[model samples]
Target: MSMLAGATLVASTLLGAGPASAARPPQAPAIPVAGLADPPAEFGTDWHDPLTAAPPVTHPTGKSCEVTVAEAQFRDFTPYKGTYAPPRGCGDRWSKVVLRLDGKVQGRQYDRLGYLHIGGVEVLRTSTPQPSPDGIEWSVEKDVTRYGDTFREGHDVEMLIGNVVDDTYTGIIDVKVTLTFYPAEKPAATKTATKTVAKAAAAPDHVLTLQDGTLTTPRNSERIVAEVYATGSGGGCEEYWYLTVPDAAPYSCKAGDGPYREVQIEVDGKLAGIAAPFPTVWTGGWSNPFLWYVIPGPRAFDIKPVEYDLTPFAGLLNDGRPHRIDVSVVGVPEGQSGWSTPVNVLVWQDAKSTRVTGKLTAHRAGDLTNSSTYTSGSEHRLDTGAGHRLTVAGYVDTSHGRVTTTVDRELAATSVHRWTDGESTDALKGTWTDDEKVTVDGHGPAVTTRTDRTYTMDGATTLGAGDRLRTVLSLGDRASVVETRGGRRTAWSRLDDSYAGDATYTANVPRDQRHAVGTTSERYRLYGSDGCYDRRLVTVQGTLTGVRDSC
Candidate 1:
């Protein structure tokens, strides 16, 4: 069980009845309080709730049905188990499905990690927020329409927020989750309506679970995708993997290979895909909970899974044989444990063909490059670099014709870490990039979709005079996607999410004497092809100071 999972807070003034109106013009989300005073000299019993600049889940109108997934109070490692059934009022077909989770906690507690699984399919991965003495409440929403097949039928549900409640930690997490389904609008003709319904629910025909790290797909599977919820946690050094140093370095956390880490997927001993995991900073990260009392670094409350397009391996997996599929992280000690990876496979099958046959045409892998150099001085330093590339191609016979899919992926990372003699002042600057291109032939003109993702981190924590500690941090998550057919651009999109924070507090003292003060902000901007969205949020001393939506 992982020690930390999460939540964030929203100001009472910023709370809305539902998703914001898209047509509304850009403006301040909340009016600034008149004559807002400076922060107090010491910590208080209460503060503003955690919040982010991320957009809310938009819903469609017509008719909707809702179902309660789970409701429980988590105080230990025990998991809440229940059963979920589709809503009766709404038909089997749904135009969109949205998931919402509301949680509240009070008293003293550390961040804990949690996950929600329906019928053995992982739907949401999250972490909890540390609460003030007066307590706090938060909510998060996600689009689970892609998991339509999982919710269409009754399934056993399981949820857990691993925690410990004793004399020192007293916060018990209370949460409730629900799913709302929007029915598709009626069309003029019955045949057209049938087609529209089918297209609307064209997510995946089958959702398969991994048993003992093995997978067996249907013989006629046409497209295959695997999503892995990989997290490095367990309240240990792995939780802060980026700060690890070589064994020779006199650091508290040491890794044999320094701080470069990558997540890789393998099928039957052959590498299938590789991805750079998002460096998540929990609510209590960087030895300071005050920095994240309001806005988390990035993707802290909601963890998005790393996805792999295994269509190139559909030919091999369609053999109807149990094949071993393994997920592993590259930079851990020989016999240590600190990572969790749970996988779910999504498949689309051919209606006409009972068996789809093909062969693996080509597979190429570039040598992995990894290097770490260390220097000892008043300011110890560690410089690290790593990268890898993989390309795979295969063809499968389908109802339409013979189809070929090729996938090319590349990942690279570089970082510079520095710290004092006793680790009084520790800092790091790092960047990771993952680039992928998928091309499919034999379906009209050849089409290709390319995606470029980049992640960054820059932060420093220092212990100064009078037991005073300060931390300054900045993080970024950026990506761009483009699609082209026959060398002509067809569509594209871009996203830039950034966060910055500065916090200070007196260390090694009672909660009431810590005298903590901090300010944090996040700006999320997404634009292209479909539309544009821009939002920024700022918080000072736990109070939401500003929220602007420029687009």
Candidate 2:
């Protein structure tokens, strides 16, 4: 669960899957990014040894089964459905499906989670990863491949392992589930020829709930978007909203108490791509299960509507001219002014795809000037000799401490492709010895490797304003790891939406090596504070938690 394969193909669809075949038909699906080719057909944990007796079974796709349940009384519950059918004519070659789960749960107590239905919906959901380091195993994966039309309509795909962990609590909960199919006989969708630029009718898209959220336009596309919906009003730490393509800009700032933020994309301006901001499918009211986790997925929904890819700057948005697509937001929601957060500014033009030439030399971006100190550094470069060559440097030093608001954002990036969604945040309201360091590098031989990284977050938090105060939160991640490139081993694997450790790759990182680089939490709340009380701190996947509303 080192952040669970850094998964974040969040709603992806371009479809591609057509390789690997012993004549195909073993159920097919190994979700290796889908297109298929090599081996691609894996299942783990000896095919479900003791999963918890079930009431469903119809294997065929890489057949493997098991279900067992011994006891449970207190907060008792059960929902272990099943389904695996894929030997028919193969619905338009469906193309895409990957569901992996390695298990090991010898409970000291209990509290389970798992659900990955197919047509009956429920897409994918998991939570049994936290074992590793000798305590047995733990693995997880989900790329439902958009259901492949509910597995070509055969239906029945289900998986629900449940346990509330109460009723005096009984133990035992083991799991293993696998599905890999990337079929494509005649269908796989990948046309390409889009051109939907729009957002000028005086800047459309609304529902900011209160105020301050804008999206400008001048437009030229290759995929430039700013679809927003962050609803947590009153959370700040510089309060962000930026996206300029002309002189390079990409920011979606957040100090923490997150509803799961992260939305940055700047191509001509440098840093291209980073998406994470879509939740809010529904949010009725009363919520404070200790601040908030209203639990149930998408990080508990804040209002949904999140989509950001920027198409890797689509060659800096194809220079056919026209360019000004701005977006603004300053402490929206909860900071006052009614608190609204909604903005939609999209552009997607992939006419035929190539026509590249780049230059983005932003060597600095740390200017809060009189707002109370700031200084950022950069050294960007992007060449597209048919594509592949992106070097980005980094430096940041922020200070505005009285109560606390210090930041240090040192980043590095090299690209030969492979930089999706986004995740890089560091906010400290005060004291980490003041925290400040910089020197991050980047080199991308087509995603080859070269990342000299240095941007750390140690830990700190304190709150109390009276009215029976009680809101203690502590966050830690003594940041450390690689800062070199070349060869086939670069550390800093993948931990989207939250900076600070939880690697996977293996690029060789020994620079300032410091493990346990993240995930060291401590939270306690009691909010009736009456006046001042707002929060923010996220790093879910590497740990470091704290999300707002404490009373």
Candidate 3:
């Protein structure tokens, strides 16, 4: 079957729902239908299964093997623990590794966050979709080849999807995770001269996890990178940190510094890296679960970690001593706990050298700029703007010679939130941009890579006549990257992912009587030196109506 046809089949089968009604009476007949249909809508026993337009993991063509990592049903705080062993037939070195998680849930349930860890290295951080009464099944795949080092050995695995299963909320999250590995191809034996393909860089030599907020790297570490799975959650205000207001403002969620939040990494009491966290909206976000019954927000299913090039600090951490390495979310209220930051450090060692020495040549951090103004009136408004910049440079004496690396990062965000008294109508429009540049000057010519990232959210929720609530939202995630050698562009890539939805339902009503109606769509386009991919998905009520591939 075609991709679109397959998607439609899956949506129908998984949701276990019927076709949407064409003509139905609206709760408030006087309110003219504005681009949306009336309710007694499609939502019956279930809705369209959750899905995204992101590209799937491409498997390599070679001998392969699969291993089941974890299988369990999560209903509370308890986690699933098991042992993970490498595939038997697959060799230690793999050309590619893919991790896939399949999950199913039925009955009523709220969106819950989850994670998977092997040997204490976090490999996946995801969130579940609010389930339909009948049930729904979804899957997510990620290319985990970078964590090859962690998978080569037998290690303990832990997985959790914190949830509550009571009489009212009866969904139990059932999940099974597996890994597939493909062996590397042998080099061709040819006497004749042939074009050579540059082999991709090897995976990290070691994957190290933090111990009590401290890190210890290999003495001969030549290159180091740190990835942090930072999330603002705990079913509290931090989950909606972007919409928070200052303490003086009359709002449900309050942050002393307003809605501006930045994720920062510190090493030995000094700033190492800074980043803007992506504003992720769960399936039930904005008080409208119908908006996401078919399509979720960007990065909602597969949460990508904030990466930092920590090679500059390799010298400081290579002393064979545990150094204090901390991750913190700025702008959170003091003494409040709602953020989870689990760190994984990847290290590349100097194979030919027993020990490598280096020094941090430069470290500079500009003052943080944050401003939030609140205006009180019939429509209360809060406006905020924040930014920060950091630059670090260092050199390591490797077996190949001296290698100098420099990293620069900048983050900026602006948001405007407006709401009526008692939050009868709430609206927010926000944008965040993160730009980073890395330069490496070694034995050969200097090479530089620049990446620019942008995220946007424009959404509003309003309560109207007959206790009918409506939400209209649009979200965007875009990025562009360029690699230059000696000031000449060698490679470039661009990505644009956007989502929009309009949904409405009766407020404070039983699940079956809410009369929810929604229309959601997503368009994902990615182009790079390798190739191009573009796909669009649309859903009305609970059925997948459109799935188009333009590229």
Candidate 4:
């Protein structure tokens, strides 16, 4: 039972060379410290860049996924009593797991799997939180814990994978359960088995020509070159041609008087004249480089290509590997209560077309549906994806129960969208009363009529260039700016509440401000000065910016 859950955690702590040691608990099941001298290993390689294509392994490229699982030690951080000590049975065979990549068993250690048929014993769950590339390490999700009580039999487990510290790519890396069991007992560990998996050969990249045609070879040939000759008659003209190759003697052509005779022809490789019955002659052969001759005149002629044997330009391969590009589109589907499902767009460069088909999600119509004092206007939400710029420009007509939303041609948002039935009530609605019009509590209908069927956005979402850290702040004329970190919204207040006055105002990005550079935390504060507090609401509305890498 202990091996089934806690053992993986313990093993991960012992193997990982990170903060896992400090973050791990002393009482936690001990990691089996033996047999690492010759343990198996693998690598998970993502061959594509996020802006160009999806991983060929998962797409139509038919390439297999490369797996790389590093053995690491945990650095326990939880506070402990007096002298810190390791947990009991730290070296006992506690668990075992078989690693699999794309359904293929890749690695395994631990006899429990073979003996008892337990699947998860050999697997080790990581405790170190994925760190940001900026060298800052922070755990986004809590480490998985093993339950000591269920030790007799082993359980199944999986470790999520991706560029833990990089937010550029989409989807988590998943190592599936394969091996059957792991010995909970500790033994002298030996490490050394697989160093790295062999990667596939890179493919060639062709350069597009001015006409859009890919240029794979040069236009010069050496075998046989065809020459053209033209002749004009009383009413029109006529022409004929053939191929020849001059291995040595400098090649030349001629018309009348020359071996090949004609009026307006070529001789010693020179044009002569133009005449009917103009027997324009040429040679058909191949040389290191091929050449062609053009005769002018309005005439009829038939010619054949001279087969050539020559060396063309050798082909070259692309030294740069094709990168995986992530593409996602988020918007609300028409006609739904909450929000529409978020649409995920996926495209593989090795495949045809950039159109992606995936799932979507929806959200609430109003920003504050739970607030009792205020009624929200019509609105919906949508997203393109993290670090991507998305602009949604379209009309929402809800009066007929049909909601039509067309995003701008260039906009791509990877987020959820909501739908509205198209209806809102304000002071114009008279009062809030049930259809019975009994006036309910005896008080007059509320002042503002709550409206529905409105349209709004899920707003803009921005994530850190590496850690996925995000913050969003929105502003409006009568509305104060509300800021949200992660998903929690911050309370709003004037930059300086002491100031008293009725003034018109606006917010602006400081000209000298280099908003997104060199820092884990970026700051944006609301400021209200002088008499700018009561009179005008400076609605400074804009999506969060500078979360992705520096532009």
Question: Which candidate number has the best TM-score?
Answer: 1
The digit string of per-residue lDDT tens for model 4 on 148-261 reads 122223233223221221233222222222222222322233331111100000111111111121212221111111111112111111111111101121112111111111
Which stretches of candidate 1 lie above 4 Å from their native place? 1-43, 186-201
**For this target, which candidate reaches the highest lDDT against the unseen true structure?**
1
Candidate 3 residue lDDT tens string, 1-551:
00001021111111111111101111111212242333334677866678887666656555899999999999999999999999998888776678899999999888999999999999999999888889999998877877888988999999999999999899999999999988755556653212111122346788899888889898999999888898888778888888989999988888898999999999998999999998988887888888887689988888888889988987887889999998999999899988999999988899899999999999999999999999999999999999999999999999999999999999999999998888888899999999999999999889888888899999998889998998999999988777788898776767788999998888877777788888899988766654566788778887777777766
**Whole-model lDDT per candidate:** 0.83, 0.27, 0.82, 0.17
Query: How many residue pairs of model 4 clash at the backbone?
Result: 142
lDDT of 2 by residue, 204-293 (tens): 111111113222222223223444443333222221111101112122332222111233434334443333222221111111011111
TM-score, candidate number 2: 0.24
Question: By TM-score, how accurate is candidate 4?
Answer: 0.16
- For model 4, what is the C-alpha lDDT against the true structure? 0.17
| Per-residue lDDT over 38-122 for candidate 1, one digit per residue giving the tens place of the 0 to 100 score | 5555457887777778767667767899999999999999999999999998987676788899999999999999999999999
What are the TM-scores, per candidate, against the unseen true structure? 0.92, 0.24, 0.91, 0.16
What's the number of clashes in each of the models?
12, 45, 0, 142
Q: Which runs of model 4 end up more than 4 angstroms from their true locations?
A: 1-133, 139-146, 151-157, 163-514, 517-551
